[model samples]
Target: MNRWLVPALALALIAASAASLLAGTVWLRPQDVLAAIAHPSDDLPGLIVLQIRLPRVLLAMMIGGILGLSGAVLQGLLRNPLAEPGLLGVSAGASLGAVIAIYYGFSASFSLASPLFGLAGGFVTASVAFLLARGGGTLALILAGSAVTAIAAAGTEVALNLAPNPYAAYEIMNWLMGSLADRGWDHVRLAAPFIVAGGALLLATGPALDVLALGETQAESLGVAVGRMRLIALIGTALGVGAATAVAGAIGFVGLVAPHVVRPLVHHQPGRLLLPSALTGALIVVLADTATRVMRLGGPPINLGVLISLVGAPFFLWLVLHVRTRTA
Candidate 1:
């Protein structure tokens, strides 16, 4: 692994985070941001920097870090370069839960109803997938996840189609687009614990993933508990990704892209790839969120998820072509 890779990613993430704090409707100078952080005041700049941007930046980091970490673990566990956290249906299930909350006006009654429902949905779907894939190998797990994802996606679509009012539909659509805008410390508080715990669980599996890359049979013969590792990966991914989706809505592609971007730098060692992938993911999200604030795309700014998808769609195409070329 390149010695400088992790440090480089860490430095980049720091820079992006700074940019996120600085770039907004009313841009703050470096000095202003520092002042706000050092001694928060009731002034507009202080409020903007401390209350608004700080929470958003922190949430972005947590979400991105978890997504990236989970992606690396999932890819390693499944032994598939194309694998990502969403392949297990957590994001879809979370979305369905949030949509259900919005559709039923549960969000109107309780601010956290959507996120809470989203968490429950993610856990349930992941549990179902695991149960279906029990005693089976990676292929069965993948198939089970695909099935759950389809079901959750269908539920989300049904809710959207049957929305009682256009306003509710608009709210649902907006949330699905995903954004860090208007997010306060409450969201950070809601998601922090889950993301942290989930991140720890995923990171712990790095060594096992490295061995499992050789083949499940070989890994078991080498005294690695493959089933236990799979369970850990699943639970970790579900918790982290689910909480992230619950708060931020259906942000995508970070998990899929972050691991691939850092794999070469880590010499393709799954264990070494985890931390750098997480740093890269945080950098990507911070940069993307910053871009959303500065860009003048007419009336309102671009949605965070939409902007990411725009970039990720092209990257996905390139990845497919690259994979085909290698195989060919």
Candidate 2:
């Protein structure tokens, strides 16, 4: 796709997001949303639209884009379309740290500390998986990822179960389910730098990813430093997925599905796919989040992660089928 198209699509998505943000639990027209943006605080609706919904939507988009790009990079590196931070235990690791911090009451002491710890946990798990897979092939990577993920997920469940405070369990449950209902600029401020930096790193690795698409020996013959590229890409994935999950919890399927949805827009060129994947991911998350806020079953809202899983599970099955056919 042309460079202009990405920006154009982003703009359109932003506009749609803005409209959806305005039409939240209480419906508001597009003109009302525009008026609110123009003169925020002039009315209750304006304030809610500009101060509350808008920020959350923007943050969701940024986080989703980061996850999408990170997924694309990981899939390219592993030569597996099913590879994602969530599958590789990166999200589980981050969730473990964040939940631990929250359960231990550290989050109450310092707001930034939760994410810092979460980042550490994410890196640790990713490192373990990488080491376990380093000398082996795709099978090793998958096995390592599954093992680490299982362990970390069990640890998270244990922590939640052992928490003294009842609220802690609920909090962990909420985080696990994922939601953008009450997020604000502070969440955005906390996550944006890491996401942007990680995104830059991912974008920088695109050329190396393109070479890796040609198979390992061919890529090495073409002068691509395979090991170095993998290291950088791993670090980038940790940064992007860690920071996003730290803020939003494990918002699943964006990374796995975004690239697949937008790959055709880029004509199946791995390098060109990144931007479109990011855009599509951003659009998906923001729209899905908006749907969560708007759609209710009598009282409580639906889980964001559940919504994504509903969509992602079938997509995953289809991907497996396609991959099997291709290999066969």
Which candidate achieves the best TM-score against the true structure? 1
Which digits, one per residue and each the tens of the lDDT, describe model 1 over residues 190-262?
8898899899999999988888879999999999999888999999989999999999998889999999888
| lDDT of candidate model 2 versus the reference | 0.81
61-176, model 2: which lDDT tens digit per residue? Answer: 88888888988888888888777768777889988988888888898798766677777888898899889989776567668878998999999999988988888888789878
**Number of colliding residue pairs in each model:** 0, 0
- Top lDDT model: 1
The per-residue C-alpha lDDT of model 2 at residue 108 equals 77
Residue 4 CA error for candidate 2 (Å)? Answer: 7.3
- In angstroms, what RMSD does candidate 2 have relative to the true structure? 2.9
What's the CA error at residue 299 for candidate 2, in Å? 3.3
Give candidate 1's error at residue 235 in angstroms. 0.5
